[model samples]
Target: MDKRINDLKKMYMDIKIPDNIDSIIDEGVKKGEIKMKNKFKGNLIKGISSIAAVFLIFTVSINASSAFANSISDVPVIGKLVQVLQFTGNKAQGGQVTDGVDIGMISLRKAKNSEEVIIKFNKSQDNIAPCYSISYEKYPYSMIFTVSGVRKFSAEKDFEALKQSNFISDSYNIITLDDSAVRFAINFKKPVKYEVKEYKEPAQIVLSLKECEKGNDKAAYIVRTASYPQGETLGILEERLCGFENIRIVKDDKGTFAVEAGTFESEEKAKERIKEIMNKCGSDIKLYIEKREANQLPKQMQ
Candidate 1:
């Protein structure tokens, strides 16, 4: 046995060694690692691209179909995404929709104490005119908002959403008339006054619902600086009117939004306010006086 072991040791020592063996092995290992890293990066990019495509499809589905938007809105986790998606263009509803107009989703934007029901129209087709009318009904108290050139499923996917709102009453519904139109029969819990405004860009209609304020009706004189469309948003107008007293925006029946500064009981006081405003604002500034039917006086800040 000892003689055999000695012979094996002699044979092992007789085998020649390569001087470049370490360098060769290191080069091979480095090549293998780089190949693996490149493979990993390719897979990662493909996966991200696939995910982006799915999300794009999902967003498109939401935009093109109101039923899908309503379905996703009820979801527990992704409910907030509905806020943005509901407003996207639905101009691509191909054949099944009505003849004239393509209606987008109807979303109820609720705030701390107010609610605005928004109805969007696919204004992509310039050939179709988006026209609507507003009327009031009593006894049951319904705000009849009739839109021309629309059908039933046009934008009515979310009437249940309006029903769920604390600000609105039940049985708020949509009625499709024989004349290529749909009427939003919004029933309220109590008598309410609404201000309707038209918007561009996305082309939408907003209904600002205000429950009737009950108290006393008195003559409140208003000094209106400039006349803008009724229901026009006061975006940065207040910033321009800085250093003014009792500044608030009011809408008159003539469908104009005017910057009202200082409430007065008499026309004489309103005239004095107009003088003050002309002095502060440009002398060429257009100013006028109007009387607001008394509800609670608007809260005034300096």
Candidate 2:
């Protein structure tokens, strides 16, 4: 065994004589392995970067597409849309409704002229249950153009309604009372709509007689205004009060009920006649004379 070991050592020394040969070979192999590993790592990093960039692009594209879709929804239509509807005259069957008040929905209708548009209401479908009056004004800022007389409806909320009202009217056919001024009224069968935008008329009926310090004789005939809690219409009331043979109702520019009874000549005679009226009318009455026709007064009063 000693001889064999000595022989193996002599053979190894003869085969390799260079110093640090094992170290040099080991370093070269290790460097080659490291370079290959580095190359593989570099390829992995590039692949990862490419994947990340694609994923980011896809995410941004998705978000941008979604935003564009949202913006398009807010634009207004370029043209008008028409809807054909059937009018059975069966008033609106359901929805929020109030008592004694008529609710009507509106739609626009263009005339043959096209420029002229009308807010047409569906009257055929409108019905009144138990008979009632319906007064409606266009919503927002429109005046009521149509007022239906008292009619009967089978259902409570029955009124076929359509409209094309656009412009707003500050004045309409409704009469509005101003302040506490005493006003005598006679509703004619065909009563004209009076627009008294302002209250400029002096109080025709002086509630306080003390305001008129002058003796009653000073003023010939006095114009009086009175109202009844219940009774006949305005024309009927005027006929009863003004015993004139012919009576005509004319609408003053101010929109007041003027009973132009036959012009009187004698203020004293008119005053005497007023006394009779006071006795008959009981209490609430107002008196006035034709301010323009003072010449019609009695010779002394004039």
Candidate 3:
């Protein structure tokens, strides 16, 4: 399944899951198998939430018995188990301990120029993740990561490399929840907005962190409702422009006139305004959002 990622930090948190975790997982396994058999099926995932919905199964089964957990660990991706059996082995001595991918490495570092902090998990397989959740918290401003049905954690060698990073609090704590699960609690140097992305062939989980500004203005959205050639007369266009707030005809150097409505930093407000305009102006009027710095608007379009 594609379309980058699902919102956001916790895939399981935002998506609605069916009550039957067992059937959903079985369906995912069967679909994965079908995907394998059909080598060149062109139609792919239409929505990213579909994959997110499937992953919700893992989190629901976190407290399941050790045997059940083991079975979940073997939840097939394609034809093989989620783990690379040759490299990672189940550590359950006598009882039912779930099989999981061996954590090959945990790489923590800052982006070369930006203040972005990246945390990558190199697992034995592409779907390195099992039943996992990431939660963002305030108070001291921290993020927590937990996963279940894990086979084992690698030694502390690569984990020590995190000290080289100045992005986060530099004091992350790891707790072994049990033989089959683990938890990591980490704090940001300051408050940050985080994104989760996963890649397969080599099996990776990439967490991207961007420090939040004091006032996080995601974007300045202007809905360009209409446009006319600079020297042309307004004629019927002016009739459509009535009743809109901050309605302005901005003249750019390129000899074009833009009929824009509203300067909203809040994306939701801009979208609501767009819908109102679309409904009032009818579908014939083309409307789209243009993002720019709050101050740059006047300078670029006089």
Could you give the C-alpha RMSD of every candidate to the true structure, in order shown?
16.5, 26.5, 33.1
Q: Write the per-residue lDDT of candidate 3 for residues 214-262, one digit (tens) a residue.
A: 5333447776644566333432454476688655445322535566676
Q: Which stretches of candidate 1 lie over 4 Å from their true place?
A: 1-99, 127-129, 171-179, 214-302
What stretches of model 3 exceed 4 Å from their correct place? 1-98, 112-128, 215-302
Q: What's the lDDT for all of these models?
A: 0.58, 0.32, 0.52
**lDDT tens readout by residue for model 2, 232-260:** 34445565565543232333334444443
The TM-score values for the models, in the order shown, are: 0.36, 0.21, 0.35
Q: Which candidate wins on TM-score?
A: 1
Better of 1 and 3 by TM-score: 1
Candidates sorted by TM-score, best first: 1, 3, 2
The alpha-carbon deviation from the true structure for residue 95 of candidate 2, after best TM-score superposition, in angstroms, is 52
Quote the lDDT for 33 in model 2: 99
lDDT of 3: 0.52
Predicted structure with the largest lDDT when compared to the true one: 1
Off by over 4 Å in 2: 1-233, 239-248, 293-302
Better of 1 and 2 by lDDT: 1
